[model samples]
Target: MYQPDVFAFPEEGQSGPSLLPPPGVLSLWRVDVARHCGQAARVAPGILDAGELDRAAHLVVDADRECYVASHVALRILLGARLGVAPGAVPLTREPCPSCGGPHGRPATGGGVHFSLSHTRGVALLAFADVPVGVDVELLPKTGVVSEIAGQLHPAESRELAELPEELRPAAFGRVWTRKEAYLKGEGIGLADGLAAEHVGTGPRPGPGPAGWTITDVRVPTGYAAAVAVRAAGQPAARDGDRRR
Candidate 1:
């Protein structure tokens, strides 16, 4: 049972909190987009890079754009503080595609830290670790849709969902979905690898992750589900003295 250092956004009009997770300690930060909506325009311009700003501008829906800007700004602020660089100046790169070698997979930084971001509805989640890491958060689907998409999960997960009482199935299915996604993203591959190919079963706790990876369920606000995955055992954990606010 890995416990992540969790941070929440401060009250309105206050500067965002600084974060410096202990080395080897995975940090999970959650932001409520609605709480930051009023300050998005003022804060986002200062934190987001040019590419991120441009991308946010092209989002057709107002809520989607707000979430995009809030999530990216939070990522930049947190990572920048840790890296000792200005938020907008933090360099973010993508890993080459495993199949085609195209530069369009997981987002990365040159400083050796790994991170992943996920957002839905009005909430965003960011995770940071010393080793490669992926985090995913999803808004629980409606009960009717649970059965509709059950087949997309691994056989074991699907069977488990079938056995669950109807009211409990959506949340159970969400756990499986997020666990699978976090593992895939940590591997630098998105759903392109196929969710059905892996067998992370449905339960309050995560089942075995892909070999060499560790998966853990994340505590999230009601109506949302989240998870994080990191390389099981590899490089030494980052040292506490290495981080600066």
Candidate 2:
């Protein structure tokens, strides 16, 4: 099994949490956006940058806006604490798309810290590393969506899911989805690049990622699945003994 260093943020009125994962180490954090919704209403006014605030404003759904603001604010707070900069002043930008040259790809920064964020329902996940990192979290599939999209996965993954007991396929599909998305996100390309091209296995352990990239499953709350990917020279060893609280 893969284990990542996880962190819990301090209460809203308290000082921001400080996280400093060692170089080459990937740190993953899971935030319950619903728990921080109230704090977002208060802290977002000052903590979020103009761009983030504007984006939050454009979200029509109240929960969506709250999740967006809370996640972005949490990200800024973590990044700012790590870089010793004001959260509101953290310089954030998105790399141009490799296919169309549009500024809509992976979020990036110049401080030598790479990160990726993803959220589904009320939960959000963030990942940080010295090298490119990508993270994805998904709620358990409750409908036919998994089966509908199974064909989009790698051929082997498709077959794996096809053979699983009907009751177990959703979790298996979620695992495969998060693993594939994590790898693609780490590559600086999102789902726009397509999912069928890469084949992360459907088993509990992640399959090989593209060259120079390592993918690992992240333990998350029940009813959800998450994974993280990092660019590395070689595969990362399972942290069975290094699991941290």
Candidate 3:
């Protein structure tokens, strides 16, 4: 098994172990990056780049602003801990797109380590590994919203959802959405590739990844759905519908 612990961020002023996971293993960190007075000191200093600050400033909702700033600050702190650098000094950039060579692609760091981040409301998930990785955390949608979007997913996935009981389909759709987004984010194509482009099965557990990748559900707090996708390093595909850590 990879690192067994899915750690919460250290409380303010507390120190902890290196945040990097073992090679072929992923370290997933759960952070409560909400906006509040007590959390401000730790958060403000970690807002390293002007771009982030500007983006955060443009978020009109108080909660949206809070999630953007605090989660990004948390990302830098975790990356700094892993790399032995000051949070502000971490080399953060974007990789070129694999398909169009566009400047916007996967967010990246200069060193070999790979990571991905996703946040919903007050919480964020940070994933780290030696190989390319992507993760997503989402608030479960309402039953009606799930029904409306179900038709846009892969045909097989829609059929699977159609077979599920009405009340169950929302959670089921959340799983499928998280899985698909995780894989697309890892591939650096994102929604530009379209939702119907990939078939991540709609089931109690995740299905197999597209070639050269592995997808699995991430066990998160109730009322949310989460998943992670990792690029293969010539290793056998991860066992699906079982690996939760």
Candidate 4:
């Protein structure tokens, strides 16, 4: 069984088994880097010059931005390994969505692989598939203010949140939010299309249509909530989707 509880940091030059997907099906790994650019450079080569990495590290290494940058670095590394391409050759630049020009963007090899990146706390999680996909994580302590933002949730999610008692609200809120965000990210719709949480029991929701999605709960530590959304449409082929910059 794949065990998140058993996770150990990779030693220099060695990699760990993926926690997000079944063993051997996906290659997910984590690394703690001192700065954003070095992390990025480690995951995707040449995407940052030495100077750029140093500067980005200085700008984003703090607690607030570390998670997002770490997620980017994790994805860069995964794709580089799976595709047998140079990390820099994977196209890590941030670009506006072609459909909505929103901040939602992703790295692409133009080789047919869809992936998503997310981080909370110091750990970054990345998901890659043969179909469009997205992944998200919520660091629990930071998610407490979610009630104020609860109105932003899809109507169904709001109702569900209302049912949860005050104490359990935070976990429930994070679960739905991550689920919706992951689904939208898989669709390449970003938040512009708006996300909704439709609960069909407490497990993975398979898509309703040809272009719908498949969402899976990511088993992780107690202090966090996570989910992975993968497109259900067409044959699963490699395609990159939205990723945090």
Candidate 5:
């Protein structure tokens, strides 16, 4: 695990809601910083701290395990500081599940917090909060893969991407892919759940009711597109596209 640059929470006493949830309501003022790195050396020791990563050795059995350990360590430290708990006592675990698999394969802790993680290249992203959350990022391929995968995305999403100008196809496809992925993650049923058929257009669109999901476009570096999906109660003011930064 690596340390991230921490910042003071905003004076407003409201921390931003991640796309996924139990929606940490304790205090919005806590800032959990993150970084994208190709190797562990890039992480700052001050941010990661020793105690936070004590369990990291136990988590590195595979590539996914490595990513999860690093990501969890980063999140626990940030969230622990926010919640006024000792970073090591924050209780980060592998998210136990004996049967569930596919997109919703996340591990859960006892508290209301829920999270989902995804990584591509060397970057990993963790989405955590009080609601069920799922997040994904993809490094865009300049080929016609997006167009070819049109049938893979929801019908409306496919149409939207098709309508995009030639140069914008990549971006449009990335957006829809991330959104659909995030939605599926929130549902606890990843891509194997047939995304094109279920939850399509079931989002914030009127007459569609609330898809019981929220999506935020994540602004990762160029060539990589990402989105976060969170399930929330009522309609948080920050609904679909609300977290599109």
Candidate 6:
């Protein structure tokens, strides 16, 4: 599937987003949004666009607003490093929806690159690829959440999740949900396409993705789950600078 090595986001003044990926190499990066929240006062500021700044300002709660700022700042930093433009100048936009041709699709950039971003309260994940890609990170949900949502998945996936012990269902549900979301993000259809439409499994690993796409679970900190999806048609070439955290 060409999932590149996962990297801890580079700190201020440090090298870069996994040493700034070489041309055509798929790259994934993770950061502690909560941790970055503590530094938002200095790290945010001019890195974000006006829209992002306004969005962050509207998140009244301190943690929520800071997390929003931190994640977006980290996104701009990495995208800037990748596209060789200033962090504030990365030309970000959404694509046309694959399902309806609406202008509300996955996040994208003007430079010839494909990327995806996903973040929860404490964690943020970013993916860059030469091919269409989507990535997601989510905290483990409550068992009640699992019970409520598992049935909305594909029949086979619902059955797999149902067979699990209640204590284990949350992580399994996390896997299933992240994989499902990642796949959809890559397809530029989002959840409006219906969760039951695809059968990303609830097991430790993901099942086969839609034709022409690849999905897989990604390792993250305890209590969270992450995944990435990429078009399999034209996987990027491997590079020697690819790294791991």
Global CA lDDT of candidate 4, please? 0.54
> After aligning candidate 3 to the native by TM-score, how far in Å is the CA of 120 from where it should be?
1.3
Model 2 C-alpha lDDT per residue in residues 1-245, reported as the tens digit of each score: 45544434456622457547677667787777788778766878878878778998999998788778778877888888777777777889888765567998679876568889988768888898887788998888953888899888778888999998888988998898998788778766677656777678888888775656778888888898888888774534222232111
> What TM-score against the true fold does each predicted structure earn?
0.87, 0.87, 0.86, 0.68, 0.59, 0.87
Q: Each prediction's Cα RMSD? A: 6.7, 6.4, 5.2, 6.4, 9.0, 6.7
- List candidate 1 segments past 4 Å from native: 1-19, 235-245
lDDT of 4 at 128: 70
lDDT of 1: 0.78
**Number of the top lDDT candidate:** 1
Question: Candidate 3: which stretches are off by over 4 Å?
Answer: 1-16, 35-42, 234-245
TM-score of 5: 0.59
Model 1 agreement with the true structure over 57-166: per-residue lDDT tens digits: 99999889989987887787778767777777789998876545799878998666789999887888899888888899999988889889998877778899999989
User: lDDT at 114 for candidate 2?
Assistant: 82
Lowest lDDT block of 10, candidate 3: 236-245
lDDT of 6 at 240: 20
Looking at candidate 2, the ten consecutive residues that score lowest on lDDT are 236-245
Give lDDT: candidate 4, residue 112.
51
Candidate 5: Cα lDDT at 4: 16
**C-alpha local distance difference test of each model:** 0.78, 0.76, 0.75, 0.54, 0.52, 0.76
For candidate 2, the TM-score is 0.87
lDDT of 6 by residue, 72-101 (tens): 877787778777777878898887775666
For model 4, what is the alpha-carbon lDDT of residue 110? 66
What is candidate 4's lDDT per residue for 1-245, written digit by digit as tens? 12222223233312333434432243333334333434444443344335435654676546644554455545554565565554444555443564656755554456556667776665566777766667777766343586677666666566766777777777776676677666666656567644443342222332232235566667666777677776665634223343211
